[model samples]
Target chain A: MSTADIAGKARAPWMALDKLGVLIALIAVAGTVLPFAVFRANRIVLGEGLQIPFALEALPALVLGVLIALGIAIALMALSPLVKLVGGFVLLGALMILIGLAATGLIPPGDSFARVSPGAGFWVLVFAFALMVTDALARLRLGPWQRITILALVGAALGSLLWAGTFDDLSILKEYANRAPAFWAEARTHLVLAFGSVAIAIVAGVPLGIVLYRIRPLRAAVLNVLNIVQTIPSIALFGLLIAPLAWVAANVPGASAIGISGIGLAPAMVALFAYSLLPIVSNTLVGLVNVPETANDAARGMGMTDRQRLMGVELPLAFPVVLTGIRIVLVQNIGLATIAALIGGGGFGVFVFQGIGQTAMDLVLLGAVPTVALAFAAAVVLDALVEMASTRERAR
Target chain B: MRAGLLIRLVVFALLVAFLVNPEAFAFVFAPLASNGQPVIYNQGSLLDLTLNHLMIVLIATTLATLVAVGLAILVTRPFGAEFLPLSRSLANVGQTFPPVAVLALAVPMLGFGTAPTLVALFLYGLLPIFENTLTGLTGLRGPVTEAARGMGMTGLQRLTRVELPLALPVILAGVRLSTVISLATATIGSTVAARTLGEVIIAGLLSGNTAFVLQGGLIVGVLAVLIYDGLSAIERTLSRRIGQRARA
Candidate 1:
């Protein structure tokens, strides 16, 4: 045999034991041994863990048998790319359905007080399978557009599952049911606080950045001020804003009339806006500075005004970096908005703090999940925009 | 340079003065308080709270640096290269997930206390360290590494003697960022019953005492700035030693 062929044969088994294989093994072991769900006697009480077999007791024996078989197949065999991808989806789907079934099955008839929450095992299994699917997708080396399409598909699937009430039995959903109205209201406030701040930052910061770039001397002083502002903690900034804003609202003419105040949306918005300026202004400066000299010279030769050159040439070329700043601000503002609730600003953090106060983890999840999802969504959308902008510039 | 040194000394003196007797600053905050309200946060000693907060941040940042730098080293190596995507995703994942949300989520699993706060801070801090270390290790000039290889240096020796030293400044920058972020995050940990500076802020917010709010906010803000300044100085020194330009 050829040396290469001999080496390939010798390395076959070890090659099969790749990262995905190790992950799948972890999934199987964790899924089987750890608690799949917790059976809480009621809200506000600690729950008892139910292992996989007990958690899935309500499911048909055949379903459990299939789950075990699937786990073994994915773990023992070197899965084909297509099989791994499909297997991950199937496993996740099966787990979701089975968990719901288990919750429903575990609840005694007419006992509405009891709750069934997904335990550590359930999360671990979900995380592992999700990682496996992600790994499979990476192996396939799909384009950005393809990856985003898959993200949309996965999002839609999850949405449909939620819409279909697949997890209605889950305590998180139960908490959601209790304050559906408040949830939507808080969600709106969260978005407004996050996006409004970013919108303002972009409008003001870009122009300021351009001025800074033009003036040269003002750049360092202005940026140093912003840097100091950025170094301050979000909560502290929010807290500091209260006294001055309260004073302004009380003493300044027409301040209170325009919704300016120590607490609520005004202070939160201002604090977030202040926090946002550094990234936007600095990135805008960086982007404009990096715009090709050739483009600027061409514009000048074409008799374009300074404004025209900046608007038509520099900004467009620099659009991706500017968008990146907005993305950072948006994601950051979303997270910070949760803390805004502490000062009566009204956002998802209202739920978070309330959940903490009440010792209701599901309520905390209600706040946290959406905050994360919003940040993730903002990041993905902005990332896509940045990519499209950069590619367009490259093409030009 | 003299002015900068003077400013640093003043900041250090102020931090020491505040810790030694926070009530001494009560006059500064008194005007912001409503009638008859105490102007200083008195539930916990400001020094104790500040120390505890710093302790939490130190622990979390150290742990995050170790794990994240190790992961970066692993994924950059030939044998562990397949895990690069996973590590990249992890670093990306850290930024998208807010520290507050992570902290809240951790409460459900680990329950209320320092443990959950540590987990949250550690998770949140990982990205900067990992990303910077990866960049530092990989961004070395080809000739530099080639010369090391040509000198009959083993992989471990080359890594220790050449790669890590060159990468130290960048890696330190990452640790600085992580430490500052963990400082902010650890403040939020107070909501989860962790003894942090946020306790004073929360107390102020809860009681609607502007002075108390100012005290907490002032201390945390000053602490963050001092720590940031201290780290920047170290980063600059390291960068200068390595003949690389220091990044602010």
Candidate 2:
């Protein structure tokens, strides 16, 4: 066969089957077959819950039109690469809007105590949309910076929507509404725990790292200890800290005055600090050791003292790597800080455990979504900072 | 170093003995009490808890390694090159999302049991192995592969005999990291009703008993250290072998 004939044969089948065809089909099947929401009387009780199944025939005219548009977008995915990409995003956005509309419409404002939350069908649709977006972004072949920019823009748009009370009618938002003050307070406490631990880690870790680097004999022992410390589960570490801290609070004259306690910020901060140290310490040692020997010699030739050389030459060279470690520690601490709640340290984990206890999924999501967002945002921002620092170093 | 290893071995033996018969050490914990009563974490056998913890971690890490290595192999091939970014981001999502959140999200679909914990552990363990496998595979020397090809070896043979052997050290490093991480993370499985060492810690938290917490933490911490050392030794041996092979 000629090359043209072969190309046609190859392209035809792929063209007929879009990249996101399977996800769209899954969403379609789930939306048709499953309940969209469950109606419950009040948040905590699950008795006599009514399932509100999804039916295209039952949807309002506007929602039906949107669904039709989404279907068209899915159909258009097989046409061309550009069309497929745009169609994928359109399908995603349309599906989100449909979910919002359906949620608001199905749950009347008059019935305040009767809660309507998302069901399995809603989750499947969300998953399908996420898959569609991921596939589209991959096909787009955007650079990392460009992709991050798009992500930030989308995030900003979503934040604005949320700020504008767009999703206030949702059950999750209702949960948030009930505990608005506590949510903000817990968020503040979470930030304090994460940043406070990171700060302590830097203070302790950097000096320790320098000492380890300067004293070769100490490196292995120190790293081994830190590695072992790191391998202890966060919960366990928090647990381990409680007795010692409580003892200090009771025995030490001024300890309780400074917020030292068995179950609260003190042990939580200590655990987080311990967890953050390994990354910072290892990255510092690695960064310093990897700095070119020639640079140090040149600094020495320039009549620089050891301290001066370290501050001016070595640290600048190693800054990006050290920052990378800090970035890792920061993101890690954000996630770990959630565990502070389990210890009565008062972060987002409060919502999570409380939700589990009460069997309220919305409460769990309230705690979880923000924690994930914070971690993701921290990573993205720090990655950008590291990139910027490295690029500047390369330029120099 | 020998003495250290010997001490570690003894500690491990003692801990195992204590776990198998925690009541034997009840006197040690008797000094610590909460609510005017001596604290005893006797809800389950510590031996069973430790075993279950190990099993969950092993299963999760094994599945993670398989999937991660498979993805790495796929994306290293010419046809799957386009999926590199997609796969990387997917793995990043696995790490960026906390294990607790994963457990929380999973419990609804999988129900509260080993299944959700396994899913959480598997996801949490993915990124380290994925990144390491990618680095190991992509960092393979083109000259070595070319030499293997020149020897009239097929692509599969070259990969199996040359590439994988050379990449084994790095892959082992990845596995070591994943295993260590999963070991620590598996403790959280108790929250989802999975039998794990975390149960002791959780019970201690609820009952205001520091002794139970210490007991659980000590076992998990020591287990982590031992396993970490074991894996590091294996990695060191593999690297030495690879080094010797390269010199030859």
Q: Tens digit of lDDT per residue, candidate 2, span A342-378?
A: 8899999889877766778889899999999999888
Clashing pairs in 2: none
Q: In candidate 1, list every pair of residues with a backbone clash.
A: none
Q: TM-score for chain A of every candidate model?
A: 0.93, 0.86
lDDT of 1 at A102: 79
List, residue by residue over A105-211, the lDDT tens digit for candidate 1: 88888888999988888888778777777667667766658767877887898899899888888888999999999999998998899989989999999999999
Q: Give DockQ for candidates 1 onward, in order.
A: 0.73, 0.55
Best by TM-score: 1
Evaluate all candidate structures by whole-model CA lDDT and list the values in order.
0.85, 0.79
Q: Model 2, residue A301: what's the lDDT?
A: 99
lDDT of model 1 at residue A132?
70
Model 1 misses residue B69 by how many Å? 1.2
